[model samples]
Target: MTTKEIAQKYVELNRTGQHMQALEDLFAKDAVSIEPKGTPTEHAEGLDALKKKNEEFATMVEEMHGMEVSDPIVADNFFSCTMKMDVTLKGMPRNHMEEVCLYHVKDGKITSEQFFYTPPSMN
Candidate 1:
């Protein structure tokens, strides 16, 4: 897949509620993830750490009420999109979260990702 195709597929999968699958299919094994600064985990390197980080977030969410994925804007090897989520965390009330995610594709696979979002206060 080309950069555009990979970016599009990433959006399509997430829009269709296939979050995990998107990572599994589009990301490289040694991909790096950067979380917003001041977060518990600032960065995760490699697929294993990424998967574990995702699982940790999943465990925090009691329910995902709604989600919105914006169309990606692709440029060469980079793509970006905004995502909004309404979720209820374990023992916490529902909260609205928004993030702008930037991805870098190398050799037809996502090699790095950085997410910008406010840190949600967990009750």
Candidate 2:
């Protein structure tokens, strides 16, 4: 798939609550997920690690009020979109989290994804 195709499919999957499916279908075997420095999951390399990271995060959510994934803005082998989630995490107050999700695609598959967001402590 082209970068635009992959980006669009990714946004669609996230919007439809099929995040795991998106990862399985679009990511390269050695894809990497990069969270902000100092976070518990600062880096998850390889598809399996990425999947585990997502599962661990899901376990931390007490309630998901809503989620929104914007249409992607694609630019030659890269894409970006805004993601927002309203949720209450385990032992934490409900919060609105927003981030810029950037992805790098190579050879028609997503190779890396990095998210930019303010830490809850900084919010």
Candidate 3:
């Protein structure tokens, strides 16, 4: 898939809580994911690790909503996008947050992702 398409699909996967499936299909076997400090998951390496992280996130959040794509920038093997996410934690108030995700693509699959987000208090 094209970088833009891959980025968009990632958002779609998150929105639908199909992250594990998306990870398996869209990411390279050795893909790595980095989460900014204070997020539920910190950093993950390899597809299995990512899947476990996604499952934990799904369990912790009562509801996941409000995913919007913005500011897509794509290059030869890299892409960045800003995403808005609304999540309702199991016991905490809902969070409306924005994050920028940078993706490294190789051989039509995402090989790495780095995330930067505003602090949770600002969300």
Candidate 4:
């Protein structure tokens, strides 16, 4: 798959609440994920660690929907995209969040992903 395709699929999986299955197919075995602001750690490396982080996020949010992708730029094996995430927090009102995600892909799988987003408070 192309980098854009992989990025789109990632959003699709998340919107559909198929987090684990998406990780299995889209993420590399040795993938690294960086979510700078929240959770168990800032960085998670390897599939096992990444899976754990994903599960943690899934547990935190009550519902996720209305994903929109834009500004997709791909070069070589790297891609960057801007995504809007509509979600309901566990104890908060619905939110429309915007994030910029940079992806490093190889052999059609995402090897690394870095996300930049304003905190929930800012949203």
Candidate 5:
């Protein structure tokens, strides 16, 4: 798949709440995920580790109110999109969070992904 194809599929899966499926189908085996500094799961290397990170995150979510993913902007072998989610964590108040997600594609698979977002205050 081309970068545009991968990006479009990713956005479609995410918009439909098929995040894990997207990861499984689109990411390379050694793909890396980078989160903002100071976050609990700041970086995950390898598809397995990324899957584990996602699982752990799911355990922390009390409820998911909604999720949205914007159409991707493709450039060369890279693409970017905006993701917004409204949710409440186990011990935190409900909040809406938005993030810009950038992904790199190589050999028709996602090689790496980096996320940019301001985390909501736990209080």
Candidate 6:
């Protein structure tokens, strides 16, 4: 599958709440995920680390009310999508959050993801 094809399938899966499946199927074994600087967790390397990171995120979510995913913009082996989530986390106030997730594909699998999102308040 080409990058555009993978990105299309990824977007479709995410819109249908099947993003975890996409991750398992389309991400490379050595994929890396990066969060913005100054966050509690910054980088997650490899599929196992990705799964652990996702588990951590799930543990923090008290509720996920809704989510909206944007169409992916593709360029060569790169793609990007923006997602808005309405969620409430354990011990945190509920908020409408937006994140721009950028991805790079190699050999038909997602090789890396870097997310740009609103930083959480520590107050």
10-123, model 2: which lDDT tens digit per residue?
Answer: 999999999899999999999999999877799999999999999999998899999999989999899999999999988889999999999999998999999999867523
Return the candidate ranking by TM-score, descending. 5, 2, 6, 1, 3, 4
Error of 1 at 92 (Å): 2.2
Model 5 stretches with alpha carbons more than 4 Å out: none
Stretches off by above 4 angstroms in model 3 are: 2-5, 11-17, 119-123
Compared with the true structure, what per-residue lDDT tens digits does model 4 show for residues 6-111?
A: 8778767766768798789999999998876753457999999988887787787888767776756878788887878899878888999988888899999999
Q: What lDDT is obtained when candidate 2 is compared to the true structure?
A: 0.94
lDDT of each: 0.92, 0.94, 0.82, 0.82, 0.94, 0.91
Ranked candidates, highest lDDT first = 5, 2, 1, 6, 4, 3
**Candidate 1 stretches greater than 4 Å from native:** none
- Residue pairs with backbone overlap in model 2: none
Question: What is the TM-score of candidate 4?
Answer: 0.77
RMSD of each: 1.1, 1.5, 2.8, 3.0, 0.8, 1.1
* lDDT tens readout by residue for model 1, 10-122: 99999998878988999999999999877778999999888888889898889999999999999989999999999998998889999999999999899999999998764
Which scores higher on TM-score, 1 or 4?
Answer: 1
Which TM-score value belongs to model 5?
0.97
**Candidate 4 clash pair list:** none
Clash pairs (backbone) in predicted model 1: none
